[model samples]
Target: MKITSDLKYLIIAVIAVFLVVNLSGCGENPTEMQNQPTPYELPDIPGFPKNLNIPADNPMTVEGVELGRYLFYDGRLAGSSHPDSMMTCATCHVQKNAFEAGIDNPRFPGGKTRGLPSAEYPEGKETPHYMLPLFNLVYNHNGYLWNGWVSEENQKLGSEAYGVPAEEPFNFRNLESLVWMTIEAPHEVNGDIEKSVRMIESIDKYPPMFEKAFGTPEVNIDRMSKAIAQFLRSIVSYNSKFHRYLRQEATLSEAELRGHNLFFSEEADCFHCHGGSILMTTNEYFNNAKDSVFNEERDRFVVTGDPLDIGAYKAPSLLNIELTAPYMHDGRFKNLDEVIDFYSEGLVYSEYVHPLMKNVREGGVQLSDQEKEDLKAFLLALTDHQMVNDPAYSKPSDLP
Candidate 1:
């Protein structure tokens, strides 16, 4: 094959096009493609529901996620005496206990020199409003917290959802500041979050993380949050005994199968609120199954000023519902049965109750004791024993 001038030029043109497509990524912005989260796969993630919504800026990658994971467990996010804060993301969300509060404790141990479950019950309400679990958050995006105050999707855009208004105009100068707030929030990591700004500015390890992840030495608030968000996006849990049964990889017992059917059926009415493969939330707002907020407006409403949005809270994912308890926004129901019974008998008939509520003011859906037991069995199936103690996610003892 003798190469003529025309043929050689043609070959070079084709190579150029291929290299362009490979480099800039199909003619679209590399950042745009990076922002979208990867979809959840089933055989791999048994209960895998769907791909999480990744913001255009905070794409998930192995190195970024690993750094975020370390930052998540690092108590330095929380403000303490130089480093004695003892409160990391794991501080409240204890990993072994399914990223929830400790046993016998209804809430996490930090926050609130004067905390209250609701403003109405201000006396000794020091317990946390809810101890958030770290499961399926990649699916929910910013829907992790109980009250759902900070509305960052995969942690970007702004706390103000598109149509939502920002009560405090300059609330977030950028995403990094908000990242600071997430850790600083007493309920979250009890410390001054901005302190991280000065420290990271001086540290060598953090600078490179920012450079590789965000392509800059300027690690602002949004960049910080984006890096943290990468680790969060990586913490998706879907494998479980029940999930395996669903995928036909494992055998489900007679009771487990029966419970499964009842879960989706109308008699249990559980499907309306706790439906889909995730088995708890559908990434929308709900007015509590049989629960209520003392001051509906004061809770999340303080953040999002929609009047009709009173008493509404994000639907929590049911991945590790067994371990993450006392349940509900107020932590009112102590156990699953108490939670079930609240739906069964204690549901307060109110105009504001979640329209999905089976036991809505229309006398609500009624489930017998046996049916309740069956539903509880189904909920237990959602638990993942492998996740609670994943060595990859446990605390790093070597870190000081």
Candidate 2:
């Protein structure tokens, strides 16, 4: 039958309505669409690795990083509002010190960080090991901390005693796990996760920020962990003098150039673990013959359960090494000079000493005083002054 114009329009309208109703369910979830965060693109640093360790479940986002930065510096993150009682990631990880408590840190004398004082311990609990600088961590696939404990390779579930449920996100893996672990660790914030979550949820500023970041205003430990991890990953440090030299934007001094040659050459032998990458780390652990005995319960051996890993610890990235003083896993050396001296002449023999220490039999590399000074110049060239002074990584001035 031939349809009238009015009849044809009505039929078309009815069909359109039916299509809309049916297709709506098939489309992306409106709630999820609304919660979709803006993707945060990391800067394309020169000679830096493209493969970041960002988790698939928690992708980096502009909103997430902003929220993470706030959470990172918020002293109230410890579930406490009191000035004396509060603790934060920034309490120990100061940006000026390359996110490490510097040797001169008054709070942590000699750069040895400790948690807030508690009734059980009036002096406050000291961290098991010294702080590692928080930068270029996105490139670190070999695991984290001195012993490579919190890693994707690790299958250990979180402890029920600590309120961490045996779940996907709660497992000892990735930077997200590291965040929650820090909150509960006695030597860190020593905080209760539930209380921390409730406190953040009660805050006026966070819920909206959380919604912007993760699609909902519901503040949980998982989201908090993911957010903080994003911020930590965002802390890149590739703008050092050496990096500029690589980019042809700057040149090194005579001593720095000589030191650079020594560093990459077998004579100085620093490149075995700390060279060959812009990230400046092999991301592997080593027993660098600091002592003849191994008794530290938390050494790499504890993680691997291998006899060879008895005294092994991570060879940290040398980026901004100038600022991250009181060197080594235990903060044994107070300055670069001391570290250079140790590797130069103070190498202690150990049964578990890494084979990389070829000159261990001769006590050390045995460099001259002039060579030592030159080596330090090259190390200092790795310092990214821009990173430490960058306002973006700094604590928000208006934090509540």
Candidate 3:
């Protein structure tokens, strides 16, 4: 058993390797590799359709959603760490406003939000369109945003599909794609992805949270995007008085009941676009006679490349629609009364108008004042107070 020089050297090498492996925590207790994320259970909403459009690559998880909630509210997610320059998704999409920049939102005067200040631009750039609510997004299988630009199929299609310059990246295929776009967009965060990643990675608290969520301490744009998307998807709203009435747990007031009938009746004809048990929206695009002119590049026509789609926008959910005002893509209507008035008499004729607008020829449905009041009551019944005050969706108090 006497060791030769070669055998002795081999034994020493083995011992040294073992020591290094143990020191690096790669041996027995590999906690890093065991950092598996716990699956998040989506709430069971009554009467809502199932089979949500969650991506397989990035499944929902408790830790991931928690991390996303923090990032969703954190201004640091913007490309820079400076307080003045920092802007978060929550800046425009507040909980009180049904995740939209409400007409009264302090940060967004007249419900318009601008990004970081810049000397080059001088005047800060504002978002081209009004903010859309983020709740019940899991059900929007066709796409995200007003024009359905962020879609599952479009990710592979690239910018050419949308008629954008070939050189421009057409990476928008899902909600995750919005992260990078907002960071780089001059009107959003006015930031760079690399800088954002670096900033988050450098934060002492975030790396540990990232590890818990993704099983690695490494923080990157992809992980951040996935996390935020999860949080956004988890923001379901089905606890309204209307929802309770549907579940047989409560009863609607007489006014709300009358409004409900008016909304569904042929007189109002409101269920065509904004109907569905859980979502309150068909999630389809329509011109809706918002404007006769279809010049904006953000219109649905940009995505479809069809002239008929001009001035078309997605039919937003009526769930929490009462809180998310001013109504329409541009936030033109100041209140539900104005919205009802527009639908009553403000119908503009357009070749691209949705075929479902049966009363378009008559300008609008022309509901009586009493009927309009009832319809507004019905719309307000869809408002979920629980959604706006949910602690889970609020900003993490631990964050500075």
Top candidate, metric TM-score:
2
Minimal lDDT window, size 10, model 1: 109-118
Clashing pairs for predicted structure model 2, backbone only:
none
Q: C-alpha displacement of 186 in model 2, angstroms?
A: 1.0
Residue pairs of candidate 3 with colliding backbone atoms: none
The models' CA-based lDDT, in order, is: 0.60, 0.91, 0.84
Which run of 10 residues does model 3 get worst, by summed lDDT?
Answer: 161-170
RMSD of each: 6.6, 3.6, 7.8
Q: Write the per-residue lDDT of candidate 1 for residues 264-383, one digit (tens) a residue.
A: 777666666667545466766666635443554435555567654567776777777888777776676678888777766676755566567755664445777777777788778888
Pick the winner on lDDT between candidates 1 and 2: 2
lDDT of 3 by residue, 272-321 (tens): 88875557899999889867777788989999998888989999999999
TM-score of 1: 0.74
Error of 2 at 116 (Å): 1.9
Q: What is the lDDT of candidate 3?
A: 0.84
TM-scores for all predictions: 0.74, 0.93, 0.88
